[model samples]
Target: MKALYFTADKMMELRDIAVPVPKKGQYLIQVKVCGICGSDFEGYMGKTGRRTPPMIMGHEFAGVITEAPEGGKFKKGESVVVFPKPFCGTCEYCKKGLVNVCTSGICMGVLSADGAMCEYVAIDEKYLIPFSPEKLPYDIASMTEPLSVAYRAVYKISDEELQASDHIVVIGAGTIGLLVTAMLSYRKAKHIIVSDTQEFRLETAKKMGAHTVVNPASGDFEEAIKKATDGKKCDFAIEAVGISATAESSLDALKIGGTAIWIGNAQKIVSINMQKIVTTELSVRGSYVYDFDGFKKCVELLQNKVIDVSSMITDTYKLQDGVAAFKALENNTDGKMLKVMLEV
Candidate 1:
């Protein structure tokens, strides 16, 4: 088997490796498609510490069960999408179904667990969610994880707040942000506004049903959003960029008593105006990845065409070109690449 690994010296190297053998209660997955996430790019640029040196970095992926252990629930040739978050089922948090925050959990590709950036991976049977290859393509199935993040972010919003005419702003036009707006559109939310600094992403947002798209670099983001709403602030906001500026802008653009659902995890320390949060009686909540039910919901949403992400993929690469794929993400100065997939 061949795998793309981040070397200790800070570069993606494609190397030949032995195919993994599944342990007890595990299945050998022949990885079909793997999407390089934003975090993967961050790791490539040495921005994140989660992906240490010489690690396989990919969590958003789909594969087929090639070697299932005897008595396994699934069989060989069955396609599935992996719930890459490893958790201890006996933990208190997992027992309460808050597996997203599982204290004893490990996020594959992001943390210590090796991920699906290779041709084959041995995954525990518990984390595999079976799907039909005919109904959903491998690349789209691979999107289950990231789309689940967007689904959870919007799903966390109060149902009473999703008025058909309520003003909403998504403060980033990346994949999660775009999907957040897509989910908003799916639920018939009105007055959707997507803000970003890139022209291509804003265009993609517009296509995804953003009622308005504003380039934050063009002018004051909050002011532009306010102008769109006749000087009124958004009733809800989702901060998809984890920087201090975008995180603060979510509060800056919200109406009195509004809520902001934060979904990004790029930076550690971010400064916000506590005065604005208190004075406006606003609520800012941090949303984690989805629980088991939410993950299933995202899959159903994708299958039902409720959240069409067919246009989300910007490029594809063979495993042999994996290094070039990561390089494309790193050198994406034009902001043209939205999602890059590796065909393993």
Candidate 2:
């Protein structure tokens, strides 16, 4: 089997490797497709230190079950999406259903895990998500990770304020931001405002159902929010850029009692206004990856065509062109590229 390996010097190389056998209670999945994530691009640029070199770094993926574990729930040759993380189910967070933040959790395709960049991976049968291949292609199913991440972001919103009557703001017009915008649009949110410095990404946000997009590089995003909302403030805000400035922008866009959720982790620190938060009675929270329940719901949403992901796949590259795929995603400075998939 062939696998793409990231080197210590930040280069990608295709190497021939022996196939991995499934461990106890695991299935051997023949990887069909894998998506290059923003984090993956970050790792390529040597920004995020999560993925060390000499690693197979691909988590967003789908595959066909080539060998099933003994007494597995699903059979061989079943088309499935792979959930990237494995949590210690006995932990407190896991018991409370917050698997994303479970302290002992470790994800595949990063650090010590080999990930799905190869032709085959040993996956726990419980993490396999089944969907009809006739209706959903390997390309779209491979996107379940990002879609699930978007779902988890929306899930972090205060339940009372996520309805159609509430105006919301999404800071960052990238993939996760656009997906969040789509979710809000599908749920009939009263208004959706997206902010970014890049105009092209803002344009994509508009097509994804953002009622308005603001280029903060030109002016204040708070003012843009006021204009777009007709002087009304947003009830909820999602910060997806993972920077201090955008997180602050999310806080500044919210109503007096509104909530803000941070999904991006770009910087180690950001300046915050404690006085404003206290006086305004604002609720600021951090949301990690999806829990199992939310992941399942998002998969069903995709399987049923509830969230249209057809437009998210901007480009696809063959596994042999894995290095090219990384370059394409990294050099997408105009923000024209959304999701790039590897046809394994």
Query: Estimated TM-score per prediction?
Result: 0.97, 0.95
Candidate 2 structure quality by residue, lDDT tens digits, 209-313: 998888999987788888888777888889998877888898899888878888887666788787878999998888887889888888888888888888878
lDDT, model 2, position 103:
84
Clashing pairs in 2: 242-264
Query: How much does candidate 1 score in TM-score?
Result: 0.97
lDDT (Cα, tens digit) per residue for candidate 1, span 1-344: 99999885348999899999878899999999999888888877877677887788899999999898888899999999999988888889999988999997888887557888999999998898998888888999998999999888997776776863379999999888988989898888878999998999999998888999888799888789789889878988999988899999899888889888899888888999999999889998899888988898887778767788988899999988999887778678877899899998
lDDT of each: 0.88, 0.85
For all the candidates, what are their Cα RMSDs to the real structure?
1.3, 1.6
